[model samples]
Target: MNITSFLIYCIIITFTPGPTNIAILSTVHNFGAKKAMEYTYGATIAFGLLLVISTLLNTILMTIIPKILIVMQIIGSFYMFYLAYQIYKMDTSKPTVNQSGTFKSGFLMQFLNPKVVLFTMTVIPSFIMPHYIAMPTVTLSVIAITLIGFLAFITWVLFGTIFKEFLQKHKKAVNVMMALFLAYAAIEIWM
Candidate 1:
């Protein structure tokens, strides 16, 4: 595999603002660093599992990916739109009492996030499958991707912690901006 290109792609996908990253940011801003780390750990584990599942199912997916790609994209777009709306409607008046930063919440969020799903599905096929067909190579790639995802989660949480006061002061603006980004991601998925 083109390791450099693969790394670049992984970095871009994992580091970019997405539902998981946004959740981590919001969690840190509201709950505290400890809670945010719990969330991050949960998300990281889920992401790793997803990567493994995607790798294991690669052969089956390759056969059907073309046929289901459009459908998956549509589903992913709508899901993103929903998330955008939720972010826009987020209540900033009080720190969320909704357990938004819990480990379970983080796990479920990553599990259901279409952005992660699509990233896993495409990355394996496009980057790893073509060149690194060996089982050991695939396993290593999955591990690398998972670690990158963990780092991304940690980075976002740290950013949120650093800017927690600012986020509190400008909660509305932050929510709106994040909502808009998610909306754009939805549109991009469709395109």
Candidate 2:
């Protein structure tokens, strides 16, 4: 495996704005850093689990993925559209004082996110599997990927936190932008 290429791929996919990152940013913008961290931790745990599962099931996935790829993409696209609608409809009249980010929310978001699933499926099988067949190497790669994912989550949270004031001041604009981005992502997945 070309480690450099693999790493670059991982960085690009993990760092790009997706459901998880968008959620994190929104959470921080509305609820603050502490709440966002909870979501981040939950997402990180989910990401790690997904990485391990993807690595362990590489062979099985190879056999079944071709059959399910279209279905998964369709489901993912619809889900993204739903999320976009929700974001667009967010009530930004006031800060959600009671809306502390929950671990379950973060965990479920990543667990159900098709983008993350696709990322794990493709990256592991194509990059790690081809180059490192050893269990140890695979494990290390999973750990590395999980850590990188966690960092990506943190980056988004930090961004949101830093701009919390600005976001709150222009809540409608921010929400609309995020909603549009999510919609675009959904359409892209289908295409």
Candidate 3:
């Protein structure tokens, strides 16, 4: 359990710009950072749930039924498309005044995001030595990865929060940015 190596990989994966960050930052610009926290919490929980499910199933099911990977990939892709639609519709100008739904939405979006699943299933597991590592050790390594990922996401959300004012002030620019984000998301799902 080389915690240092795990942390490095986690930082790389979490900090790299992706759908979750795009969604959260846009939400923050529209609704304020406080409201954007909901999405953050949601994403965090979703990540944890995915980690547990994959870890467990990786042992019992994935070994015997390799096709679960394909199912997960398909589900993930569908969810990403749905989220892209959501983002495409987001009116940064008249975003939901009530901040209640942001967290749950963020969490669920992250949970089903195909990109997240792909990275978790393919990239994350490679960092740990499954053959030499015990289950608990592997679990702890994943937990460490989760913690770092969550913190990095929160940081990005905060950056978006701080930039919200600028985004609001430059309405036209913000719209372009949001549109670009939507396009990126669409491409990700499509690919």
Q: In terms of lDDT, which candidate is strongest?
A: 2
Model 2 residue runs over 4 Å out of place are none
Query: Which 10 successive residues of model 3 have the least lDDT summed?
Result: 123-132
The 10-residue segment with the lowest total lDDT in model 1 = 92-101
Runs of candidate 1 with Cα error greater than 4 angstroms are: 66-68
Q: State the C-alpha lDDT per candidate.
A: 0.83, 0.85, 0.68
lDDT by residue for model 2 (1-191), tens: 78799889999999999988988887887778889999899999999998988888878878888766777777777877887897798888855663547788888777668789889888888888877899999888899999999999999988997889999899989989998988897788767
Q: How much is the lDDT of residue 187 in candidate 3? A: 64
Query: Would you give me the overall lDDT of model 3?
Result: 0.68
Which is the better candidate, 1 or 2, if ranked by TM-score?
2
TM-score of 3: 0.79
TM-score to native of every candidate shown: 0.85, 0.93, 0.79
Candidate with maximal TM-score: 2
Ranking the candidates on lDDT from highest down gives 2, 1, 3
RMSD of each predicted structure: 2.2, 1.6, 3.0
What TM-score does structure 2 among the candidates reach?
0.93
